[model samples]
Every structure is written in C-alpha cells, then in structure tokens.
Target: MNILKTTALVALMGSIAIPAMAEQRVLKLFTDASDPAPKAAFEQLVKGFEAENPDVKVEVNTFDHEGYKTAIRNFLTADSPDLANWYAGNRMAPFVNAGQFTDVSDVWEENGLKDSLGSALKSMTIDGKQWGVPYTYYQWGIYYNKDVYKKAGVEVPKTWDEFISNCKKFQEMGVDCLTTGTKALWPAAGIFDYLDLRTNGYDFHMKLTSGEIPWTDDRVKAVFAEWKKVLPYTTKNVAAIDWQDAVSNIVQGKAANYVMGNFAVATFKDGGMTNDTLGFMDFPTINPDIPRAEEAPTDTIHIPAGAKNKADAKKFLAYVAKADVQTKMNEELGQLPINKNSSVGDDPYLQAGFKILSTADGGIAQFFDRDAPAQMAKAGMEGFQEFMAYPDHLDAILERLEKVRQRVYKN
Candidate 1:
C-alpha cells in the first residue's frame, strides 16, 4: 500500500472513533415511569440537557413505576446510574443512610434550590444533607365525575358526614360510589393516609412516620373502622383491578368518584374524560371541627454516590431545577411544578389542583408507604389489602403490622 493511501484510511477510522469516544461520556439515568406525560417530559429534558452540553450524551432507562423501588434499593449499593428518580420522605432514608447517594447539599446551596423547594419535602434531605431535587408533585384527593353527581342529584361534599351521606345516596341509586386501585398498593394506602390524617391530624401522622406511634393506636383503629364503612362502595373487583381499570370505571360512568393523586387527571383524559366533566375535592372532614390538611409530597431525583458522571448529573439536575424547565414539565405532565417561580397554565383542572395543593391549611406527606421505610410500606400496604377484604381479622392484621414495624424500626 502507498503511504498516502494508508494515511487516508487511518484518518477515516480515526473520524469514526472520535464520535464513538464522545458518546462514551454519556450519562445514564434510570427512572420508573410508564405514564406518557411524565415520560415525554423526561425525554424532553434529556434532549435539552444534551443540546446544551453537546459533549455529554444522556441515556435514560424507564422501569415499571412500582418495580423501581426494588430496583433502586438494589441498584443504589451497586453500579448506580448517574441520576435516578425516587420517592421522598422515609422512602429515601434507607439509601441515604447506606451512603449510596451522593450528598448534593453543596450543589443545592450553590444553585439556590433551597429557596424554592417547599419545607415539607425537606424530608428528602437526610442528616442535614440534601440528596435529591424534586421536579413535579400533586395532591391526593377525591376526584368525582361531575356528570355522575349531576345524574345522582348529589352535591360536592365538604365534611366527613356529607361524604358518607353522598356515598349512601349513590348506593341508593345503585352507583358504585368510590373507585380505587388496590392492585397498585399505593392507592389503597392513600385511603389510609386520608383517614389517618383527618382522624389524628398532621402531628400524629408525623409521629406515625417516625415509628413513634404503633399501628395499633385507637386513632389507627378508628381510621380502619371509618374506611370499612365505605369499603362496600368501592369498585367491586378492586383486588384484581389496577389504577387504569379503576379510572376507566369512573370514565365509563360505572363509578362516581376516585380517591387518587392528581396525576390521575391525565389517565382520566386518556380514557376520554375531560376536566370540565370532573371535579376535585379535599379529603372530607372526618372530624368537622378540624380544618382539612392535604397530602402533598414531591417526586424527587438523586445522584447515587458512585455515579460515573457526577458532574454531568449535577449539571442535569440544575438544568431540571430551573424555573423554565419546571414550568415546561408541569405543562407537559399535567401536574404542579415545585419551583415557586414556575408557572402553571390556565387549565382549570390543573389550576384547581395547584390551588388545592398550595393553599392547604397544612400538608402531610403521604403515609403508610412514603412516610415509612420501603419494606414497612410494602408490609403495611399488604395488610391494608387483607384488612379491607376481611375486616373481621383486624386484630390479626394489626399484630402482623406491629411485628413488621418492630423488625423495621429495630435498627
């Protein structure tokens, strides 16, 4: 081969290798999201991140939302991703304690994120150190089909008694009054939080989260008793149905309402329902004298300790923390953005959702699951399912919960 020809071939190979080497600096992000809006928003953010940092490529892996908890627990102590999404509250405690996540407090201060994030979400910060950044979050409440209520001649409920009366009214009219997705676990546990919050107030809820109060408390028992009264009104095949099916029951007019997170709005729309046809209400006054406190928690992002691209991950997180990115995320995901300066648009339902969450007299993080460790959350959720199916075995369920709680809190 001639020297000139050989040089040309080597140059061609070098050109290919250069881009491949550039791509090797890619960032890996793993999240548990199947919903279109949030997923699209994440992809959009990745595109924006890559566009701004042309030298760094971003690779994202989205897992089943429910499965992500287990995956993250295992992944955190091993070959963790550059950045990963996780639940806030006691949910993050295990990983934080294990030193599996990078301490982002310094970066959080540098970026002035502490100024915008709500105090309620500070639970994501462990041992006075920030481990994550929250993007979008929505409130948990009762969403009723306006058209169904109109046909049934029932007004929107405000107090606990009113809510029960409304349920009775719906039952009299042969409508399944409440719809739930027990198959997902969290939805069922959400009901428990609402019951507990309205019964014991936010302080006791915190105590419950801290494992200071036993699940066998009278307050806890009262919550179950009240929950049992309305259990008959929930969707008939709740154990077999996931959230989507439960939402469909309401969308198709088989059920009158759903107790769910604000994200359910998008699922409702995907099922051919719209905001005008639906309405949101706070968890009714279980005790009329006390003001209603809403459940408000953030979906958080964290950088694991061993992340290969910590600098790029921090950059990406700061990019996501920007007000513009937050607003875009809210607009795309149909939920409220955590950045105080971020704007949520003029959609009434979205606005109402924002109003409900932001204006709550006080907010408690979701309980049983997020309020407790991941393992305890799992045990409590399963107990809720069993207790719901057989109220007669309440004591046995409580005993089992106590056992698990003892094991979980022993450390």
Candidate 2:
C-alpha cells in the first residue's frame, strides 16, 4: 500500500513539473506604438490573437516612437523579435535589401491580400515581393472651400486642364488658387508627389525617388512644367507661412483649394469651416491611362528575418490582415484600414477617404519624406519649396537634385 501511494504521488509531481504543453509557442513583438491610441489597438490585437490561438502567447515590447527608429537597427541585425512594426515605401527598403525582414509575399498571397490590401500593394512591394502587411493609413488629396468654389462658379474638376482653368478664374477673383505652406518644407512635397504621380504614373515617380531616373530627365521636367501652370496663381508668401496658416487662406476664402492630407479636416473645422463649406476631391487626373494613386502614409507589421517563432509571427500577420480584425483595429485607431473589405467609421471625411483610397489601383504613396531617403527627402523638399517660390529655377533645381541623387544613392 505504501509503495502504491508513493507511485501516485510521484506521478502527480511529474505532471505538475511539466508545466506546459509541447505545442505552446511564444511570439515576441517589437513596436513603436507607444501612444495611447495605437497602444490600445495593439493591446486589443494581442488579446484577440491569443484568443484565436490559445496555443500561442505574444510578448510585446513598446518603444517611444523616436527612440524606436534608432533601436530598430540594433535589434534587427542582432537580437530580432519575432515581429516588428515598420513603415511602408522606401523607408523599408534598407531592411528588405539587407534581408532583415522576411519576404511575406506568401502570407499576402495565401491571405488574398493582393485583392483586399490592393491600395498599398506597390508601396509594400520591392523587387516584386511584399515585405509586410499594412494596417492603417489616411488619404491625401485636395481639400477646398466649397463656398469659394460656388462663389467663383467653378465646378469640381475631373481633369488637370479644367482645374487649371478654375485656378485662372480664382486668380482673376484675387483669390489664391493653390495654397500650401512650405515653411516646414514638407507640405510642398505633397504637391510634388501628386504632380509626379498624376503626370508620370506611380512607377516612374518611385524610380525618380529611388534614384533610378535622372532628375534632369525630360519626364522629370514635365512634372515641373505642370507646376509652372499653377505657380502664378499659388498663394504668395508661402515660404514664410506654415501649413496651418495656409488653412486660414481657404477658411477665409482667400484661397480656393489646398493640396493636403485628410488630417487637416479637423483644423479646418476648428477654423470654423463645416462639412457644408468644406469639400474633398481626388487630385484631378492628369493621365487617363496611368491609373489613380493617392498619398496615404501607411503603417505596417513585419516578420523579422531572425525570428525564432516565424510560424506564429506569420499567423499574427494573417490575423491582422483579416477584414474584420482591421475594421476593429482601425476604428480604435481613428484611421482607415488598408483592407478593402473593412468598414470605416461614420466620420464623413473618413468615409470619403475610405472610398477614395481603398479603390486606388495604382498604389499608395508614403509621402515625400517617407518615400525618399532622409538626405534626398530634405534636398527634394527644399527644391520643391524653392520651385514653389521661383518656378523659373526648374533647371537649376533638377540639376542640383541630379547631383544629390548620384551622391545619395552612390552605394
């Protein structure tokens, strides 16, 4: 009897010592989503991912946004987590090229992301393979004063020529037709991005920014040529003002249109413009055959090349890619989801943006600073600012940029 009791006790102790099933997995996630909103979204993501995958547990490490930018370098090459948060576009090229990020083209393919996340496909791809999954973004387009457009008797334009004609009409009425604040030097980039996207198409624009095309190329000159048409009608003193100040130009009816991101809608409301007075439109089409692309700075998640638990990391990516998951995550995030099947919130601007961006087949761009390297982005925006002030300097600007391109991408 004593021997049988000892055997039972030993069996129970052994069972207790085992602790976990052999199938239990851990996925480590590194993120810069330290802000309240994104943090909550990530928390919800982890919880939901765990619920569906009871066998896997996620451990997340959050970093302050600015610090994470520097920290990602050390971790990606040395002690990589199973997954990491990153930006789309040229911002991700280094990791993709260095093989620090796993090629997630298989995840995208098996999940049908090519159809649902279609808008961001081009931005998320390099060398014909996707590196990560984009979750959220906001649209960038023309936000205009409807009251001013009505007063000027100009209808919303569908083509670049019609828009320029309205610019002439607005100019005649002593109103600035196109207003942007370049004091910060980035907003000028929105105009240039759109001009290049509308004129030369997304591939050419990417090539230009990637230094594959010469700035002195005539195709590049054509982008500036389009800019010249609106220079005489653009708000003057832009070099001295910031983007928010330019918002006042539209608010007070001194300007008819502004090329900006959707985030400016709140600023317009605070400045006393309402949905009735404000209107959003696609940047008028310049090339009928090139397809429409929009500016929507995107945030994404990736599997690290050194990840120990790549299976679960990819499972997490697939979880986030679901339309229902994205809908919930972005609703908390107050941003539009990249999943085409995901539903957006009731905010009219978001609704409009959802329609505008979700349908863009050409691509989504991550804006100038995110799309170009830091040195090149700065030089490019400075050139844009100078060109905004002096359209006549197109040659000098392009030549200077050509030199920088040669130097910046000499590697």
Candidate 3:
C-alpha cells in the first residue's frame, strides 16, 4: 500500500510540472539583423526582454539583410512572426497599407515615446498612427577632406553660394570639388535629396518624392539649375566609377568632398585618412530662408498583424524603446541611437551626427531611396545619374521621371 501511494504521488508531480512548463509563451522574431554587429545587438535586446519577462521564450529567425527584403513580403502574408525588423520612412508604407503590420500607436502613447523618440516619431508614423519603434540611425552629409580645403586655399563653405564659389577654386587647381561615383546610380540621388530639401524644405520634398508633385514642376527645374553651378567641378568619370573608387579619390586628395553616409568614415579611415584629415559637416545650406533638415536613415522593429503572441511582442517593442536599451544597442552596432535620451559612444563622427540630427528642427529625412517607392527610387536615381552626366538632358529626364511618378503612385 505504501509503494502504491508513493508511485501515485510521483505521477501527480509530473502532471503538475508539465502544465506549468507549458504555460511559458513563445514569441517568434524575424529579423534581417544577421550581420555580426546587428545580430549581437538583437541578442542584447532579446536577453534584456527575457530578463524582464521570464515567462516569455523568444525564438528568433535571422535572415541575410538583402534576402530578407524579398522574404518579408511572403512571410508577412503566409507565416508571420510575432515581431519583425524593418526600415523607417516610406519603406515601411507598403506593409502598413497592406495590413501586414499592426498599428502600435497605443504602445507609443503608453510608454511616453512621444517625448523620448520624438526625432524618429515622424518617420515611424503613417496616417497619424505609429507603426513601429525605431532603434538605430546614421547621418548623411558632406564628408570632405580638410587637407584638400587647405590645399585649395578656401574656407569651409556655410552657404550654397559659398560652396559653389569654392568649387571654382577647386576647378582652378584641376581637382574635383565634389566627387561621387554613380555607377551604382544611388549616389547621385543623395545630391538631389539635399538640393531639394534645401531649396524647398522637408514637406515639399516629401510631397515631391511621394508623387504628389510633378517631377517636371518648376520647383524641380530650380533644383537642377542649382546643380548646374557645381557641375564643372565634379568627378569627370562619375558615371564610370563606383562609389568605392570615388572614395579612393577623396583619400588621395584627388577630390575635395564626397556627399555620403557616416558609414563611409570606416572606409575613409581604412584608406589612410584620419579624423583630422577627413572632416565631416552638414551639407551646405542651399536656402538660408528655409530651415535646415538632415538626412538620417533609420532602422526599426514592428509587430506583425497576424502575430500569435501580440502581448509578448509588444513587451519587446517597449523594451527596445527604452533609452538605456537603445544606447547600449547602438553602441554595439557603432551607429547613432534614435532615442533622445540615449548617450552616444566616443566616435567623433557619431557624436557630430548626434548633434546635427538632434538639432534638425526643420526635419529629419530618410535617404531618397528610402522615402520613395522602390520602382520610383530606381527610376528617379537613374534620372539623377543621367542629369549629372548630361545637364542639357534635364528636360528629357524630368519628363521621363514624371511618367514613372504617375504610374508608380496611381494607387
């Protein structure tokens, strides 16, 4: 009788423990943060979230950055994860419109993100509702050679006219004043983005990219006319060489400035340029009357509409949204955090980026390629490249782009 009682007690304990273990919720996370730094950053977030919610087991599915772009379209419709990583600005619009992503505005309001992540609030929002939480971003500006400026005997330019005038000095010395390789086509769009933002401001620029304004509008012509002023001083072989080749020109002092993202700082350093030699600054102001805006491409995270564990996924979003969490994550990724209260690392370039982006009251713009639809971004950039090579063809290029604009945004 005693042996039978002990056996029954052991069986009862097994049944009790199994149900308790089964109570733990599993949250699926799909991400393109497969690169070492980004992967580690997500791991930090996951670990942090798990620490706070011990009953939630996070299951992560990592994908290559490029491949995930295509994979997400299928997964979001078929087998959606509880959460996924995506880009900010117009890049996320398609998923949002298709009802693949959940509206997380409540999360933003409840967590007080309106104050802490104000800089990124505009980008992460669509139709007056927040869709995701932004975590990391990097600045885009004129990465110039200080040594080249000294060599040209000209001061750093503060206004668009001054920059154009300085280009003449660089031309006189037979050096390219502004060098960017457009073999990949996208680099030319950066120049156009700064030109439009400076000439027209952020709202107008966003309208232009969204196909609300005709590509051949008078304002568009004005932007190209500004481009003409410095055309004589840019790299002659811009259409033939890639961006990396132009980096060599900047490093060799064969070129003066390259309008590029902060990531190029690493390549510039690898090419034997130091912080002293490689100077970073905001893109020279084109219209002093217009408030200054800055370009800072941001990466974000969101909950899928079909998420099975919406509760736990929201908890993850709120966790990553914290200032301390972002500060640590961005530090690991060597990028700037989007949180207003987050502290940047010791890198001078990152620090400068933080200052300029934080102070950009005019607006924060994602890159041209990001703010436009994929097809439109491709066609628009192609037009930008052709315009750089043949300024006389501006009328033709604008008309072609206007047609693409109508077709792309007809919906």
Number of the top candidate by lDDT? 2
lDDT of 1 by residue, 210-308 (tens): 787898888888989998888888777687779888998889888898888877788898888877787888788887655456676678788998898
User: Could you give candidate 3's per-residue lDDT for residues 82-107 as a string of tens digits?
Assistant: 99999887888889999999999989
Q: What lDDT does model 3 reach?
A: 0.91
**TM-score, per-candidate, Cα-based:** 0.75, 0.96, 0.94
- Give the alpha carbon lDDT tens digit for every residue of 154-233 in model 2: 99999999999999899888999999899999999999999999999888888888889999999989988998898989
Q: How many steric clashes between backbone atoms does each model show?
A: 0, 0, 0
The stretch of ten residues in a row with the least summed lDDT in candidate 3 is 355-364
What lDDT does each candidate get? Answer: 0.80, 0.93, 0.91
The model with the greater TM-score, 1 or 3, is 3
Descending-lDDT candidate ranking: 2, 3, 1
Sorted by TM-score (best first), the order is 2, 3, 1
**Number of colliding residue pairs in model 1:** 0
Alpha carbon RMSD to native, model 2: 2.1
Best by TM-score: 2
Candidate 1 positional error at 205, Å: 3.6
Better of 2 and 3 by TM-score: 2
